[model samples]
Target: MSRDIDYGNLMHSAMRGLIKTVLQDVADHGLPGAHHFFITFDTSHPDAELADWLADRYPGEMTVVMQHWFDNLVVGEDGFSVTLNFGDAPEPLYIPYDAIKTFVDPSVEFGLRFESAEDEDEEEPSADPMPPAINTDHAQEDADTAQKSDAQVVSLDSFRK
Candidate 1:
């Protein structure tokens, strides 16, 4: 039987939710201990909003470190807003979560990499779904045996190759 669920998309959405949750926690209680975020997002995405000069500076992507310097951090359901220092000037940046490619807290060695929704090659869902090659039996075993961690390394190299 063909699988109806899109596990990859489901996992991606859940991970993004995790990002929102963490940001919300920080907004409420401030950064806990040494935890800081390295949020990388597509500056050119339509939903992303930044200063004109900033967009010119980072035409493709930019990673902002939210350690000791960011202010007015707000996480919304679909996006976030933050004020960060830009050469002694404070610049407000609004980034849609869909535009965010990665979120990392290197202090805790935690990170998540997301596939850019703007990838030109992505095709719309077909009327008929394709069947997965892997068997479902091992999925439960894998889930049961896997351990949880604050960090995970996802290599884009695998996808590239």
Candidate 2:
């Protein structure tokens, strides 16, 4: 067995750790200033827990905004649970970190997008592992402007050996 450092997996783990830390801080002291998040996760993930109605509405993936009105945020080692208001009804959701697809904080123009393992497998094999794409776009932009241009995405290839 050849020993090799899996930088791609390492980077993914580090990014997830960063998300966990950020959420933990928010759960402790609440969101600060204009810092908010738009998190998109796979509702079909085995560990993802949500209301049946929500599952029916969003069969594949769902995006949740953590800005003005979210409560009972509890971040754990594996996942986080939060209660969000939807049409005057509060719904509690538990999302595992592994289920997360994209996490964006447009307030600071920062975002991270995770590709599924299957996506990586579909790509042609190469000596170097492909880095996940990081989008730095403003979600507050008008729909037309947003659609006109693609978000600038930065890759971690340059940082790799």
Best candidate according to TM-score: 2
> Model 2: runs farther than 4 Å from truth?
121-161
Q: Pick the candidate with the highest lDDT.
A: 2
For residues 18-118, could you state the per-residue lDDT of candidate 1 as single tens digits? 88898999999999886766677888999899999979977887777676667898999899998887666788999998887777665666777776444
Off by over 4 Å in 1: 1-3, 116-152, 155-161
- In angstroms, the error of model 2 at 60 is 1.1
Clashes of 2: 0
> At residue 103, what lDDT does model 2 achieve?
76
Summarize candidate 2's per-residue lDDT along 7-76 as a digit string, tens digits: 9778878888999999999999999987767677889999999999989988888877776678999999
Kindly report the root-mean-square deviation of model 1 from the true structure over all alpha carbons: 13.6
Where is model 1 poorest over a 10-residue stretch in terms of lDDT? Answer: 128-137
